[model samples]
Target: MKYLFGPVPSRRLGHSLGIDLIPFKTCTYDCIYCELGRTTHLKDKPAAYMSAKEIKAELDTFFANHHPPVDFITLGGSGEPTLNANLAQIVEIVKNLNKAPLAVLTNGSLLWREEIVNALLKADVVLPSLDTVFIKTWKKINRPHPLLKLETIINGLKGFRRKYKGQIWLEILFVRGVNDTEVEIEALHRVLEEISPEKIQLNTVVRPPAERGVEPLTKKDLEEIKEKLGPKAEIVVDFKRPIEERAELLNLREEIIALLSRRPCVLEDIVHALGAHINTVIKMMDGLQKENLVDAYLHNGKRYYLIRKGER
Candidate 1:
C-alpha cells in the first residue's frame, strides 16, 4: 500500500483508488488552498520518483485481494502525478490490470511537454486544474516554478485538447477575494473556449487550507459564476451514495473504524463497503466525530472521514 492509498470515495469519479506517483508535497506549484499542506519541493522536471515496477506491484497486490468495485483508479495523491518519469509505462500497466477506468488529477502545468501529454493518452479521464488565465493571479494562487509560464500552459491545454481523445474535465478553483472577480471569470471563459473541455468543474476552498487567507466562496456566488462560465460549467457536488442494510449498528461502526484505521475514505466509500443506510452511517460518523474517534476534512469539495492521528 506504499503507492496505493484509497479505494476512497470521490464525488466526481465515484469509488476511486488513489495512486501516489510523486512523493508527498512534491509538485510543480505550491498553491495556497492545497489541503495536503505546503509543497516541500517545487519541481518541474520529470523523474522516476517511484519505479514503474513498484507501482505495478502495489496495484497487483491490491487487485489480488479483490476488495470491491471501484469507479476509477486515479493517479493523484500528495503531489502532482505527472512528475513521475515512467508515467506512460505505468498507465499501460494499469490499463492491463483492467480493475477500473484510469483517471489522473493534475495541475496541468506539465501538459506543455509532449511526453507528458502523450503519457496521459491512455487514461479514461484527465482532470486538470486551471485557476486563472492571467499570469499575476496565476502566480499568486499557484506559486508555480519560475520556468512555468501561463501562456505556455494555456497553449499546452489547447494542444492537449487536439491530441487527447479522452474526456477532459477542466477544474477551476476560485478563492474568495483572489481569483473570483468578474474580469478573471471572463478571462477563464476565453480560455475555456480554446480548451473546450467535456466538463468545466467550478470549485473553491472548502477545506482547512494551507494559508489562513484562503477563503471559500458562497454557493450563491458559485451559481452565478457557473452561469457566467456557460453551460458546461457546474459545481462539483457530493454524490448520493447507495445505502442498504447489512450488519448491526455496532458491527457497522467497528467496520468503519477498521477501514479508516488503514486510510481515509468518503461517505460513499463507506456506504458502498458496508451497504448500510446513509442516515445510519451519518449518525455513526457524528458519534465518532463527537468522541474524537474519527475526523473529517474536505478535499475537492467532498468531505472525507479518517481515523485521527494517534487514535489508530
Candidate 2:
C-alpha cells in the first residue's frame, strides 16, 4: 500500500481510508503546526505526481480485500493532495469505486484556481483549512508560497462555495500567540461568513509540531472561539467511537510502525487505528521503545509516539 494508508480514525470523518496522491512534503504552505514536518517541496503548480491509473488500480485491490469498514475514502496524505495534477481524474476513479463517500482534505490555498475548484466538484465533502484571514498572520502561520495572496484565496473559497453543491467543512487551526488574537478572530469571523461553509471546524496543535514553541489553545479557549463563530462552528475533538473488533489481527507490530512512520500517535490513536486492546498496544510500544525504533513525547496532556528520527 504505497499510496493508501489507514482506515485510520478521524474526528470529522470517522474511520477514513487515506489516499496519498502527492509526493512527501510537497505543499503550497509550510505551516509551523504541521505534524508531518515542514514542506520540503514548496510549490503552487500542480503536477502529475503519481499516475491516476496506478491509484485506481490500488483502490480496486483495496476494495477486493476484506478490511474494516471505513466512513470516508479520503484524498489527503503527507502533503497537499490538490498539488497532484490528476486530482479530478483521481476523484472520478475513487467515485467509480463507490466503496464509501469520498472526501478531499486540503489546505485550500489553491482553491482560487478555477481548474482546482472544478476538479473537486465530484467529491462528497471538501475539508479545506484557512488558518488566518489577515495577510500578516496568514504569512506568519501558513508560510504560504510567494505567489499566494490572502485576498485571492478568499475569493477562490467564496467562488467554490457558489458553484459546488457538496458540503464544505472549513478548518481553522489556532496557534497561541499567533493567529488567536481578538482582531485576528474577528477578521476570520467576517471572512468565514462570506465563505459560508457548511461547517467551521476549530482545531489546535494536538500532535508534535514541525517547529518548536508552537502551543495549543485550551478547550476553554476553543469553546469561546466556537461561541464567537456561531452555530455552525464546533471544536474538532478526538475520535471517541468504540473500536471495531477484527476476527484475526493483522501484523500488529508492522502496522504500528507503518502508522508512526507517517505521523505521531497517542496510545488511544494506536488502539483505535489497529483495533487492538490498549494493553496490547502498550506492550508493542514498550518493545519498539526498547529497540529504539520509536520514541515518545508529551504534548499538552497526552503522550505521542513516533518513529525515531534516525529510524525514519
For candidate 2, which ten residues in a row score worst on lDDT?
A: 239-248
In angstroms, how far off is 141's CA in candidate 1? Answer: 0.4
lDDT of 1 at 247: 35
Point to the candidate with the largest TM-score.
2
Which lDDT value does model 1 have at 34?
Answer: 86
Encode model 1's per-residue lDDT on 1-312: one tens digit a residue: 567866877778989988888876889999999866678889988988998999999988888886877899999987889999989999999999987999999999999998999999889999999999999999999999888899999999999999999999999998999999999999899989989999999888776577888988888999999999889999983322222222356688899999999889998889778776454576679779989999999999999999999987
Query: Which portions of model 1 show Cα errors greater than 4 Å?
Result: 237-312
Q: Using alpha carbons, what is the TM-score of model 2? A: 0.79
lDDT per residue as tens, model 2, 1-312: 667877887889999999989877899999999876778899988988998999988888888989899999999987899999999899989888888999999999899887889999999999999998888888988999998888899999999999999999999999999999899899899999999999999999876577999998988999999999999999995422212322132378889999999999998888888776453466568779989999999999899999999786
